[model samples]
Target: MKGNETPRSTLWYFVVAHTFWKNVEVESFLSEYRFTIVIFPTMLKIYRGANGKYTLYDDGISLDYLQGDSVQTLIKWDDVAKKLSLEPASKQTATRTFQVELIPDGVTKRIQYSGRPVELKF
Candidate 1:
């Protein structure tokens, strides 16, 4: 929740990642380069199992987004960097919510999204 540190919860990360990459496009060339095609964005969900393993759900994302279920084939975190990299040119009226959870020393902390990132305190 600070700097480059994301929430440890896979679910939270997944939601963030999904929202960040909600609108993505891919372009490819057809055989002989006669035609070009645009690919649609896919929906993806991520969660952590009780065993501490990460599980990804791709029911919403199109086939273009997945090479396999394994994390390696899934889009990397950097893929959505542009979305998360936005900087407010000026104070806007629009706002959104983001949630964060932290677990340390057997203690858990929950933080709610309050629009501006400056309001967030890890």
Candidate 2:
């Protein structure tokens, strides 16, 4: 049910039943076991930046902690270039800026409701 889960097909279920119930009625026992699989939409995408930090998008936009955050989710990871955003923080300078943003809890607590970082999740 947690984020760190791998979806397994019927074959995997069968194999697992065999492993745990060797020399027993594994098939019928496993059939009795109910698996309520919940599927969540693929909301986030991560791209390894040239600078080495993993840039998180789509996922960050949904977090309550980020609701007041100024960091913009400019574009989908695939649609943009190999590098991230093409725009700068200011027109006068070429200071590189990432599209996504994260705010510290101290500031968020002073301003808004908080939720765990859904995007930065491993």
6-98, model 1: which lDDT tens digit per residue?
Answer: 332212233342322222344444454355554432322222221122222332346633554321111222222211111223233223222
lDDT of candidate 2 over 61-96, digit per residue (tens): 267435543332222222223222222121122112
Alpha carbon lDDT of residue 24, candidate 2?
A: 14
Q: Tell me the number of clashing residue pairs for each predicted model.
A: 2, 0
Each model's TM-score, in the order given? 0.19, 0.15
Per-model lDDT = 0.28, 0.24
lDDT at 98, model 2: 23
Error of 2 at 44 (Å): 4.0
> RMSD of each candidate?
17.8, 18.9
